[model samples]
Target: MYVAVKGGEAAIDNAHRLLADRRRGDRDVPALGLDQIVEQLALAVDRVMAEGSLYDRELAALAIRQARGDMIEAIFLVRAYRTTLPRFGYARPADTGAMLIERRVSATYKDLPGGQLLGPTFDYTHRLLDPQLAGDAPVAAPATREADTRAMPRVSEILTREGLIEGDGALPDDREPGDITREAPEFPMERDLRLQSLARGDEGFLLALAYSTQRGYARSHPFVGEIRIGELDIELDVPELPFPVPLGRIRVTECQMVNQFQGSAKAPPQFTRGYGLVFGQSERKAMAMALCDRALRAGEFGEDVTAPAQDEEFVIAHADNVQATGFVEHLKLPHYVDFQAELDLVRRMRAEAEAHTATPVKVAGKAAE
Candidate 1:
């Protein structure tokens, strides 16, 4: 027997209250502070910042706390908040080359100009848990010695030194760098917009797409040319501050990949570029991102293509997690109205077909004996 249901408003209110209670656990145990989440769950905060397109650690932390540790939900919170923020004059594009690099390594060169620094990585660490202590207090890290010497050159510079890699010198000027947020994507695009989408894309989605390439769904032999993580200086053109003011720094992850080169008779064989950037030391995400970027770039040059990753329109359009999650999860809402309509349509169609077949057809011509 079917029963009529009511109490939509009361049910929602009760659910909200329950959620609030759960979010803020026991009164005896202190509620998790935003700072505590930011410091302890630093990587999640990084993903929120990267995907949300904002660099505020406090806001990221708050989003994480509010989301109850759901990364995508935290990202949605940050993105929503970021839109409300006033547009101050744009900062001069960050010089990642001049970054106070914490970690830098290149697989392309064994010995480059600036030596490889494997700064702060869990790459080689064992993933097994150690139950030495249940409670461990945060402690201050040791200070580092200042490098008072000359500025370090990029590892790419060494490749440019030998004229192997393309320096940013020969770029065209006819087309301007389009802002993806400000404008809709127009076709016959450059590498910048494509990279932006992949960089801010959901980690899991990008990871799966990248994994497909390695699993023979799409094949592009790629080498991690370099991966760097560091504090990048933020220079803002503030009217109040007038001169380019230093707006502190934020940690960043940068990955560069060297992929298989396909040359035409007209042009010499040159290494193609795949680049990725995130807010923190997310090497796996960055590497996956780089592969996707390289795959998309296949359309730019006339590379023999037969892969899902190589589809430019499909990749760029669907890469946004915020959009995907919204459309996907929106189905969970009251779709009973739509579902009922579909159910009626299918049942009626089936009944009509059955009756028509069962009834002796008015023969246009003589029925088969």
Candidate 2:
């Protein structure tokens, strides 16, 4: 029953102009710069980039500005922009083991190789807001430390060495990991594709799902094995080059969760793993994604799938915020025809019911008379 209604071109144009005017704000105040957004509102930019599945800081910052700081809107813009870019080639898998570590820590271990470096985190900070931040205040420089050049071993590797945790199986040399961007997602997806979806999934949605597990909805009794944030070199193998060449470095956050599993007939008792990796310093998103990732692997480990997070079809289909928002927001568009049809049907049914009520019911003998 959808009907086209066209005559709002002028109104649409005026609305767009109003949006631009509102985005600019007060004339007396200076317009916000992209550089300021990149450096000052870095976490917001990072979130937009991570969810948008794009790595360009400049573009993400610009999207944030254009969206008037609406994160979902900003993400949509970046994702839309990403579709137009040409694909040169896929980069080699990032080797996080050799990453220039910024912040690395483990709740399971107090002392590990490359002892916990709490770099630029709000973990210990009080939640109270400072009035000084609202005004121009002199800022102090961050403390410096000697760079640790040694390769920091992954915490999961330690558990794997002791046979306490299951190993991440290596993929076949001939096979490349599935890319969700290039193809439609099918149910019962492989771990690689699932990971890719979770990496870019809505943070709040994943967070709620992760929280549900802790409350005994498909409980896994998980522990944060390690969380690391740092920069890693991205290399691309080109036909013209003899070997993979370094493209540049990008910051990322990786989280590993260890969940205990009981022994089944096919396997012995061991600790299972959930992994999350996302662009920029998104520790919360990484941790939540890891929890959901493990929950979704219930089938692989002979566990009952009893939760929303464990449902492959449900999680995969609804993870993308852009898709979710688009569908949800489309309801605001023209539904006049559809509503009119429904209204007419309801009115007709009501009138028929009223008419039938008004008609007197007669007894069998009296009706003939």
For TM-score, the strongest prediction is 2
Clashing pairs in model 2? none
Candidate 1: stretches off by over 4 Å: 1-7, 137-150, 168-171, 186-188, 238-242, 359-369
Q: Highest lDDT among the candidates is held by which one? A: 2
Mind giving the per-residue lDDT tens digits that candidate 1 earns over 140-186? 79668765455666666666667666554234778665578788987
Give each prediction's root-mean-square deviation over alpha carbons: 5.7, 5.0
Local distance difference test, each candidate: 0.79, 0.91
TM-score to true structure, per model: 0.88, 0.94
lDDT score for residue 133 of model 2: 96
What's the lDDT for candidate 1? 0.79
Report the lDDT tens digits of candidate 2 across residue range 1-369.
Answer: 455768899999999999999999998999999999999999999999999999999999999999999999999999999999899999999998888888999999998888898999999999899988999899999978787677789999998898888987555678789999998988879889999999999999999999989998888899999999999999999999899999999999999999986576877888989999999998999999999999999898778888888898888899899999999999999888889989899868766766688674454544576
